[model samples]
Target: MFLITDEQLDALLYDLATLYGYDFSGYSRPMLHRRFNRMFRLKEFSGFEDFRRAISNKPELLNWLVAEITVPVTEMFRDPEFFKVLREMVLPAVANAPLIRIWHAGCSTGEEAYSMAILLKELDLLHKSILYATDINPEVLKKAAAGVYPQNILEKYAENYYAAGGNQSFNDYYTSSYDLVKLNEQLKKKIVFSTHNLVTDASFNHFNLIICRNVIIYFNQQLQNRVLNLFDASLEQQGYLALGTKETLQFTSVNQQYQKPFPKEKIWQKI
Candidate 1:
């Protein structure tokens, strides 16, 4: 395995920002080092210089490199209790929304967004809702937009679905062929998948709820604050914000501005 020195990592990060307009400098160095070293071996780079040059000289590789480095770790209906809260509490809180707008920030491959769609459809709010699922990596967004996933994971997702109060047959939501399944059209049409960088992108629109779970953990304090502020600005008054279970707003600038509805869950309402 090719190991990346601190200096080499710094230089590579600089080039990514300067040349490709991808700013990764605010990410935690230790996390970046781990991902970069792992990437080096996965891509079969002989040494630090080889890895650095491959990215610096060839811009097209940025998509895969970014996807690999960020590691879009997500699963359908992840953290069943959180989805249960969204179904039982959050969805009802916004039940009266005329045209529900939910932003799935850092929506890696979009299982959570599809999960939300199922929740909304179950509640008969799907017709008036729009879900914007976004991620920094376009490669992942493609899969999210496609609404396709491996068939083997369906069993796990089905367990989570019912745990989240699923009202219909879980199998009814998709069709399988050749070891993969595509989510039903009803779920796919409501979501608009696109590329968004939390590190630098500005808020594009206001939303009723912003679910950006488990994404900012890789960032340092400064970047975390910036992303939180962006989400704060993007949310409408009394809008909801949900983060990963292990993540919190307690130490951030916007902590005081939002009220945590459930003590156990990370869902918060803008006050």
Candidate 2:
């Protein structure tokens, strides 16, 4: 097994953060080590110092490294039951707001953003809502802004869409051609995709709802607390926060600051 000593890891992280501004310092050790190993194998680097030098010299290589580390794996209506809970329970609380701002933090490739837009449209609230989808990886953000997904995945997405309490035909949202499925232009209008790093970046705007699913699991407890505090600051009073099924505010610093709206669904409301 390839080994990266603590000194080597620290030096590499410092170099990468100083050069590229992508901080992996707060990520879990085991996960970061795995990513480092994979990158080392792919680049054929002799050691951590060599990899660091290569990354520092090539800015483009940093981008590729960010992509590899972030693991932008997402799907439309990824958790149908979660969406079902949102539709039936949480949505009604914010349905009457004149204007709404929904933040999808760590929204890898805009599937969740588009899924949210579809839900808002079905509820007749799309025109009044602004969805901000943010991720640290520019490559995925570019694809998300383009709103094109592989056509082959449509069948599975359709199943999820229907299961998530979709009001109408799932096919109505996109046009499939060749090997790509392009999301509807109207649906795209409501989404704003941008690059925002949760670790190093400050909160941009207050949001009525924040969905940062499956993201904080990669962070250590301190970083998780920091991010949870940031989310707390960004959320409006009584605003919603949705986390991954595996994640929880329990035992964290912000646990008392927010109460679970649906414990089973992992939805929390700011107190």
Candidate 3:
């Protein structure tokens, strides 16, 4: 077990940003510490200095480090109630939109993006909708663009699909082959996957609906406020914003900028 002092931890974070341009200084210390320790152990580094040397020696390792720091574990139609609320309320508001633009921020592996595509297809709005699925990790963006997932998790995916008010058999959306399940091409065509860092990247386009679930908890309050401000800038007037159940804008300075449609759901509209 590698033990690190607070000063050393701060220095390490500085090195990551200075050397590799990967910043995690604004992240929650406990969460960052846990990930750092786990990475140190997994990489079998003698100490933080050794780990820093390794990163310096091999710049490619920064990719792995970034992945470790911004780890994302997500599923299709996660938090079923969230999607249920979207289908019942949000979808209807934008149903007649000539060009519906939905941004799935921090989309990991594209599960939820495809889930939204499926929902839109069912609602007969997919043909006019464009989904932008983005993440900080380019590696994950590649996987997300492929629209393939491990076959073993299909059961859970199907379960979540149904719970999120799926209209047809979930099996119809993907093809199973060997150990992989590739989502149908139609679903893939609807989404555009790209690399976007919520920490440092600026918003490129306005969106009608922005979904960023389960990604802000790792960030400190300051970083969270910055990100919420960015979201506020990116969303169109009266546009929708959905966050994870554990996340809320209530305590943030931008809380009044958004109005919650339902107390049970985290769905908010820019006001």
Candidate 4:
């Protein structure tokens, strides 16, 4: 039960950015407080001073904190219908190109990005495509690069895959050993995993499709709009942008520049 006040929140964010180059200033204060308190309890810190001293003494603990704070609630094919839109409409729209580049922003643990790669392979577009999956967390990026996931979730993921309009045996995507499963090497080869913090990083390249799901909930409107603009600039003319089911482009500065082709799904096309 350590609780951080509004002042302490500002100081903590400042120190993280000024000293560590991690800018989380645009994140929601209440959300940050909740996550910070969770870390304090989980790490058994008595108070804010102790927590701060621990981080000062062992800078590496900051990485653990970042991982805990930014962890997204995700699963392979988490929203089946969204993936259905990508499979049926989005991917095909970009498949005609000789080379396709898709960006998966905040791609925690790489499930959805790999799901995209699997779909591209099934559609016979993998050879002409390259998937760029980026996240703010280096810890998750390492786990994602390895392509291993806990075996306990296999049944659920398989169900999601099937529900997302997957035609082949989902089992073909991975091999199980003990309590873990690793995605096929073929799928990993086409994906490039890297660390890209949305709050601080600029657009690296143009993309035919960008899948950034369930990531913006942490930000305030200003940061969300900044990110939407970055995505808009990085996307090719008429490229696709996919967000989490609850997320949207409406009411933002870039909302009018995009059109919702599949109204039911959260997929939009840049104008």
TM for candidate 1 is 0.95
Across 116-179, the per-residue lDDT of candidate 4 in tens digits comes to 9989999999999999999998888998999999999999999999999999999999999999
Q: In angstroms, how far off is 81's CA in candidate 3?
A: 1.3
**lDDT for position 245 in model 4:** 72
Clashing pairs in 3: none
Task: Give a tens-digit lDDT track for model 3, residues 32-126.
Answer: 78877777788898777898788768756777777777777899998888888888889888777679999999998888999999999999899
**Candidate 1, residue 174: lDDT:** 98
What overall lDDT goes with each candidate model? 0.90, 0.89, 0.88, 0.89
Return the number of clashes found in candidate 4. Answer: 0
TM-score of each: 0.95, 0.96, 0.95, 0.96
Which residues of candidate 4, in runs, are more than 4 Å off? none
- Tell me the spans in candidate 3 whose CA falls farther than 4 Å from its real position: 59-61
Q: Give the number of the best model, judged by lDDT.
A: 1
Candidate that beats the other on lDDT, 1 or 2, i.e. the better one:
1
Model 2 scores what on Cα lDDT? 0.89
What does candidate 1's lDDT look like per residue over 84-183, in tens digits?
Answer: 9988899888889899999999898999999999999998899999999998888889889889899999999999998877768999999999999999
Model 2's number of clashes is 0
